[model samples]
Target: MATKTRVPQTIDAYLAGLEDPTVRKTLGALRTQLRKLLPKATESISYRMPTFKVDGDAVAGFAFFKNHCGYYPFSGSVVPALKSELDGYATSKSGVTFPPDQPLPAKLVKTLVQARLAEIAARGKKPAAAKRKAPVGRPATTGFRVGVVRTLPMTAPELWDWVTTRPERWLGPGATLKAEPGGQYEVPKRRGSPGVRGEVRVVKPGHRLRMTWQPDGWKKPATLQLTVMPKAKGASLHVHMEKLPDAEAREAMRERWSKVLARVA
Candidate 1:
């Protein structure tokens, strides 16, 4: 079998290789937005896509494909909320796509990149400061395990309503949840910022949610399962994340799920 082709270095070189005019133009606009919002970003390609790295780590990236162009916001989870405005475009968990003839929302794109950069800065320092030693033992391999449990003070149906109807109320600042399996859930760039422009993933209500969460370049899809157990007063929520590549990612996912669940509950 032949080897996969490598990605280009600079954003210009990467875009130049695309055969579709629409994908090329959209990527060009994204490039402009990245440079304007993050002056210090170093442009390159990672994972066969154009990536913008900051302080030696990728913050954002974009890709031109046959049917759609992918816009990656490395810090997808922590970006300022923008769920309402994103309705105009087609979006998935990790990125958004603009139709061939449509003009991209340059301003919103800049806001997303900046928000992701800020989020990276907030989380990057923790690993260094903690400096904990790793245990010398065979680690447990529990292939991706994702589940969601019920939150307190709410009946299963009530929590379901909140998740399906008013998701943003608990998910975070300017975030919204959807009820149906294929429905759309959004997180706006910021409170009252107009539009929901974050990850759009599989919404398996009362069961699991499979969504892409990348505010920048690294586009890995993560799935979360929400298990609701009936309690005396309320329901106990157990969230399990699964199918992650390795241990470090699994740990980070645990923390992320815990935080999001805590915010919602």
Candidate 2:
């Protein structure tokens, strides 16, 4: 059955009605920051989501979901300009998706709004490129790079728990998963360098998990997928990481993933 989308009469009610405590906290932080950042902007519920309007025009809006959350720039062009700062999250021309509990950084949000406002401010004397016809859809910027397979003597459920709970188990105390799409899948940093800080892209329990993997000094954000296929006896673990920058990077990932996959034994 399709889940019903409740159109909250107000943004407060929408945030209040959120069943997930983590989501409530995340949205609360975002709401507070948005209000502070755009004090002059009026708040209203639009299209069944929280929208902030300025000068009688909608500049931005945000919505929540079970696995992830996204923000609207009120325009497609705004996102592309701020892509570099939006690392570790999935983004589209229209908006950006961050982990449900990992609301966007206040600075990034400010930048996004600033970019949109600038774009709006320059509406006159349009550039020649702006005058030309644009493409139908956004190009796919995310891609695959390396994959490694391993047959584990563990059930799918066990494998799921093992991988998702790795940070807490391996990193030590005070560690826990953000537990939502776009949530943190951060590995502990090391040697004064960011070791393996990434974001969880997808989490299908006992079956599949995906995320972005940008090691400390990588040039681009690579993708990672961990799949658990239940076999008759145990299960097979397929670990794939992609979008590596070059052959050298691919080789490094192959070595890295190979070592990680070795743990499956």
Q: Which stretches in model 1 have alpha-carbon errors above 4 Å? A: 1-6, 76-81, 124-265
lDDT string for model 2 (1-265, tens) is 9999667888899998889888888888888888865678889898778999978778888888778888998886567545557877799989898887577888788667655554443332235575564455643332434455555788888877886777554333344565569898565665544666677767777777767777777777887666776655676666655577776776666666567667548
TM-scores of all predicted structures: 0.46, 0.46
TM-score for candidate 2: 0.46
Q: What does the lDDT come to for candidate 2? A: 0.69
lDDT of each: 0.57, 0.69
Question: Stretches of candidate 2 above 4 Å error?
Answer: 1-5, 124-265
Q: Which prediction has the highest lDDT against the true structure?
A: 2
- RMSD in angstroms, all models? 17.2, 19.0
lDDT of 2 at 180: 61
